[model samples]
Target: MAEEFRLRSVAVAVYGPAALFGLAEGAMLPVVALSAIDRGATTPVAALIGALLGIGALATNIPAGILATRVGERKSMLLAAAVSAVGLVLCLVNIGTGPGALVLYGAGVLLIGAASAVYSLARQSYLTESVPLHMRARALSTLGGTMRVGLFLGPFAGAAVMQFWGQSGAYYLSLAAVLAAGVVVYRVPDLETTAEHRAAAAAITTWGMIKRKWRVYATLGVGILLLSGIRQTRQTVVPLWAAHLGLSPTASSLIYGFAGAIDALVFYPAGKVMDRHGRRWVAVPSAFVLGASFVLMPLTHGAVLLAVVAMVMGFGNGVGSGIVMTLGADVSPAVGRPTHIGVWNELADVGSGLGPLLLAGVTALAGLGFGIVVSGLVGFAAAGALWTWIPRPSRGLRPAAVRGPPP
Candidate 1:
């Protein structure tokens, strides 16, 4: 009973901040391109500007890991929250439309992305050090689920505020959310760690740790890359296809919300499956279903049909919640775990950035539908990669070095 109580407390501490942070991100993300356009950027320039978020995150992942390793998770989180607040404040700046405005907004978005990398690494590190091996997947999945729930609700909240305050309202909402998250994190006590563990983690360089785990990175890392690519590509596929089918923006948003609702509902169950059966069970099915959905996406011509496909895509995504983080935790060493997770996150982010590029190139060569179909093929490849690479758990198999003590 005491163990359960501790687990619950940890959950409240970690997941609350995550949900709030996710809400801020969700509210802010949709307005990025629009904000750019409003600030005098061309359509293409606006798209590129919006992409700075991912670029900034990719650039900072390793550094975030290093920082977390040295300063501890709580401090890292606090620093990240401060940076995110600054970013939101920048977003709120209202200069007349020009290069000056664009530069400020772009810088803000970049800062938010960089801060997110730190916050995410810290949170994942915290959970990895707090939960026992048996409950790792469930805890991580619940973490993912809470973030998804926040994301689902955030846009509506943004819209509600937008009715009164316009695009700037979203930024205000995000700013408030991030600040609240920081407060929640501040109120929680840091996880207890031995001096030896801290010294050991601090001694190992991130590169050295990667060298030691090269095989794991080469094998499972590639699988994670492909999976992330497919998942990210799904975001583009739906809206692009909806536009192709002449669906209105309102219709597209509704379909997206419907799908997101489904996506947010399945994380806990997915985690349970991973804990009970294995990671492969959820990972394989998720990739397969997502692939199948993409393959069928081009065939849909109406809102109803597209909504149905979107729901399937959502379900596919929902089932794979926390799979990446759980896999990272499973493979990370107790020593320098933050750095290992940072590398893992970098790989996934690279894949995410690449997916849309691949889609764009393919579409330029062939057609939108063909490009989407190609992405679906990539999904199948992801499934195969995960199936081949993920370790098969046996009855005698013990958790890897990253697992913490029992609560």
Candidate 2:
């Protein structure tokens, strides 16, 4: 009963903050380009400015990890939330349209991104330490699910606020959400840490930790990168193909939302399957389904066919919600775990950035359909890589079956 209580408490602590932070992120993301344009940025420049969030997150990943290691997860989360709040406040600043305003807005977005990196790493690390190995996937998957729920709800919230206050309202919503997240995080109790764990963590630098796990990083890391790339490509392919079919923006958004709804529904089940069976069960099928969907995308000539394909893509994505974090946790040592997770996040981000670039290049050289096909091929490759690398359960080792609550 005590164990169950602890588990539930941890859920409230960890998942609550995650959902709030995700809500902030979701509410703000859609309005970024619009805000940039309002600040007098050209179309291309606005797009570039919009990308600052990801760029900042990508750059801060490792540093965030190091900070988590030093300050511990809860404190790191609180600090990140504070920084995110500052960023959101900056976004609310109205300096009028010009280079100065654009630069200020970009800086605010960048800070938010950086804070996001820290918060994400901190939460994942906290869960990793708190949950037992057997329950890790479920815990992580639920974490992912909560974030999805927040993201799905965020746009609607933003839209509602915008009705009265315009695009800037989204920034206000984000600020409130992030501040709420910080308060939740601040109230959460810290997990108990062993002297041994602390000593071990303190002994190694992030670089040394990476060196020690180079083999895992090199092999499974490649698979993770490919998985991320394919996922990002899925996002791009759906909208572009909808455009190709000459679907109205409303039709395209409906299709995308349909897929997103499916995506949001599957995380818990996926995690349950992973904990009961193994990572491969969910990982292999997810990549395979995504790859197959992308491969089949070119053949869809109408909105109905495309929506079907998009739904399949969503299922593929949904099932693998926490696969990356789960895999990273599975392989991470108690020592330097934050650093390991940071590196893992970095690789995933790189893949995300690359996937779109690859699609664009291929589209430029060949065609959109071909570019999506290539991305599909990458998915197949990811499946193969994961299959080859993800460790199989030892004989008769059904961790979930034997579990009460993980020790």
Candidate 3:
């Protein structure tokens, strides 16, 4: 039998670094946006914080994947942690309020995003190798949930630090978290593929793997891009609009916290539904639910309505994210694991990055309602693609599809 604590142990060790980075990120939203406003950032400049971060992260994923394949999983995680640490510390420098602030914020988010993509690809691949297939989805759900616990706590931590320490102090505290993350990344055990496997893969570059698994990889990548775009708008633009409507920081954070909480709660049930039913069946309507939730954003005027939306959106995202990770892990062979995951994440990461920029643009041009509606349509298209463009069976994931809607 696998060691009882194996996944949990590794997860715990890395959990702090993952969670700490989030706490720092939590501070980032308020500090970045409000600070930009203070410095007179136009809507596009304000939105660029996310755009730049995406750009930075997009630059690193392929390289990180290459390194992870050559060096080992644990080592890549370490590098990611260390890079994130330095970037967060640099963010403490206050870099003016307009473009400078956006640049600094982008750099920090980019480092975090790039490292996180590698960190996650490695971790998920390792988990797939380590665990039984029957337990795989649950494992992904639990492990993913473990990190969200940190995210749930992080915004509050950021808000608290910002409340007392001011924005600079908040970044400083976030810097500390990055340092802690680096330590954990360095300590996690190496998960290198065996020499025999490496030798077999020697003939196959990362590009080779992508060329081989283009269909499944493309489907997952495209799906993730669409889903992530929707989420980015929800997280970045919607909050700013709500805040503009005079919502308190604490209330906003709490709403996010609630989403994170409900996300974890709903993950497994959604997974079982996906497993028992069809990917398209599970994905299409859930996409509709997700789209409808955003389209209804304008109708939300209070904590209760916000909470309701949060739960619905969170549940949809939890299911979708869990399915994709598990599906990617399922498709990625042990020989070229990082390559498969890199492509998988690269698409989603870029889409997520573009999302805030697009939403911010819409908000600048029209209003939050236009952005929300556009995002909804994007998600709806993704869902429709599942019915039309995506192939009949998702490779290596879920057993035979069950007939009905999820339980």
Q: Which stretches of candidate 3 lie over 4 Å from their true place?
A: 2-9, 13-17, 34-46, 94-110, 240-257, 271-285, 299-307, 354-371, 387-407
Window of ten residues with lowest summed lDDT in model 2 = 396-405
What is the C-alpha lDDT profile of model 1 across 107-157, one tens digit per residue?
999999999999999999888788767778888998989999998989889
Candidate 1 colliding pairs: none
For model 1, the superposed segments whose C-alpha errors exceed 4 Å read: 395-407
Worst 10 residues of 1 by lDDT: 396-405
Higher-scoring candidate on lDDT, 1 or 2: 1
Ranking by lDDT: 1, 2, 3
lDDT of each: 0.89, 0.88, 0.65
Ranking by TM-score: 1, 2, 3
Writing each residue's lDDT as its tens digit, candidate 2 over 236-340 gives: 899999998899999999999999999999999999899889999999999999999999999999999999999999999999999999988887875788898
Model 3 lDDT tens row, 1-407: 33355445545554455556566565564566555555557776666654555666677767766776777666767777777677666555565666666666556666766766666766666566555555555666656665665566665677677777776666677677767777776665555345886666455676887889888756666776787777666666446646765788878877776777777566556656654564565567667778887777767888778777877888777666455666666566656667777777777777787776777687779987787778778778767665664444444444321111111
Flag regions of model 2 displaced more than 4 Å: 1-3, 395-407
Could you give me the TM-score of model 1 versus the true structure? Answer: 0.96
Clashing pairs in 2: none
Q: Give the TM-score of candidate 3.
A: 0.80
